[model samples]
Target: MILLDAGTTYAKILNTETNEKTVKKVAELEKTFKADIGTGHNINRFAKQSVNEIIALSYAGKRLIKEKSFTLLDVGSRDAKYVIFENGNFIHSDWNTECGAFTGQAIEILGSYLNLNYNAIEPQKEFITATCGLLGMGHVFDMVASSVEPGIAAARLIKGVCMSMYRFARKPHKIYLTGGLVNNALFVKSMPVETICLDRFTLLEGVLEYAASKKDDINL
Candidate 1:
């Protein structure tokens, strides 16, 4: 079975039969390409079977996390969502589409605009009051205007974005972090709490889990 986790900016795909995993821009996927099971914003356009992104996240977290009490946070290109599990049961979950706008994308744009490499940037001690990424860019500009090193200013903005997601996840003591931002070294370093970065294909794993649950009936 082919599974997809198609987000606004990128798609993570997996072929269950071959264990091959790949990432592609959403625009680059051919109209003829389709997944047997999938989740995310563009999934509806390309998937024969669709699942709620949050439901996919929950399944992946439950299957991969052995902790009885933990928070699973998935930060993507545009937004962020989290699921809380306690005593091995789902307790609370939230998806913040509004406040999380342009999360990973903003950081990427900032890096590109400044010709900065996030891998070489270090997390900053001070951060701007970036309630959201777009708003954070304004703050970053203000700092740059004040003669703060562009690299330092960018790191601070990235830290603030990280904090925003950390707070959204209810300031968990430790987080099982997933999604695109997990690949950002500075973002990972900026996390205020212990962060366990999961595979970027976590949501795709959830798609597979959902498919497996119906395996007998679906004949996967």
Candidate 2:
């Protein structure tokens, strides 16, 4: 199946059969690749069959975890989401909109600022405390000015962001961590509660499930 996540910043395409994933800029995708199944900011514009992101994640998360009740914390580009799954049923969900503090994009920007790759981050302590992404960046700059090592500054900034996200979530029994940040070793290491780090394709998996459920109704 061809699944596309037309996210605000970067767009991703997943080919399930080949188990291959590709990432490209939204602008680049706009001029190319018609989506068979799509979810994200401009789904209505790009998708032949558009699916709601939350509904998709709900179905997708269930498909992965099966009849076990769990919570899903998805930290995406512009927003972060908290989804509750009660034995594979979609029960409750909430998201962050008023601030960028809960976003994984913040981590991306942090990596650029400190020149420390997220994937390369080793286990470290939570030092930075700024909740907002931009604010955390400001703090990073201040630390650099104070002659603190860039690596340490970046790790602390990431910790602050991850911990802030944890504070936003209502802790449940089981937790699955989804989004770009899951690829980061240190952030995953610092999570207070043990979480299953899912691939970035979590939402795409949901879209595919949504499409299958609607196969008879939708033309696509």
Candidate 3:
């Protein structure tokens, strides 16, 4: 089975066999297929196309995993999403569209300001008390402008992001963290639950898992 996680910046694909799983960037596959897929475009359209490719490759069958009881938190470039799943199907999800500070764009902006790559920042040592993304960004910028070390600043930003996510979670269940920011150790550590940071193939895995389970049903 093939899993596809399509994001605003990049897409990940996971090929899962009985014993092993292989992961790669969707862009690499696009290169092989000679397609134009990149960031800053229509993500939904790209996502559908990417899933279709994975489905065709699997041949075994393709399914989009839609768990009804699981809450999937996807922190993407432009927004943060809180998705609810129940009975192995998606119920509903919420997105923080008005606040861009908690999204990947803020992270990128901070990275640029500090002249540090995203990976260079260290894990957070303190917890953030900010309630909203915009307020959090203001606090972060003030802290950064005061000559705070980039690592700690990054950590604090990550902490704020996690805290924002925690607020939106209505029930206790396994929390899945996906998207670009999942690479931050501080953010993952601050999660209230035993968070699973599927940094590599989260979305793709979801797609493949969904496809496999719904093959017989064929309504997905």
Q: Rate the local accuracy (lDDT) of all candidates.
A: 0.88, 0.76, 0.54
Put the candidates in TM-score order, highest first.
Answer: 1, 2, 3
Candidate order (lDDT) = 1, 2, 3
TM-score of each: 0.95, 0.88, 0.61
- Write model 3 residue lDDT over 1-220, tens digit each, in one string: 3344555455654445542444344454453332122122233444333333223212211122333356667666666666665675446666666544345666666666667655555556575566555566677778778987656766787766676677765645577666666875556776767777655445554454545556675433
Model 2 ranges off by over 4 Å = 16-19
lDDT score, residue 41, model 2? 71
Model 1: clashing residue pairs? Answer: none
What candidate 3 gets wrong by more than 4 Å, as runs, is 1-4, 14-70, 85-92, 98-102, 116-138, 171-174, 213-220
Candidate of highest lDDT: 1
Count of backbone clashes for each model? 0, 0, 22
Runs in model 1 lying further than 4 Å from the true structure: 216-220
- Which of 2 and 3 is ahead in lDDT? 2
The residue-by-residue lDDT of candidate 2 on 189-212, one tens digit each, is 767677789988888988877778
* Window of ten residues with lowest summed lDDT in model 3: 53-62
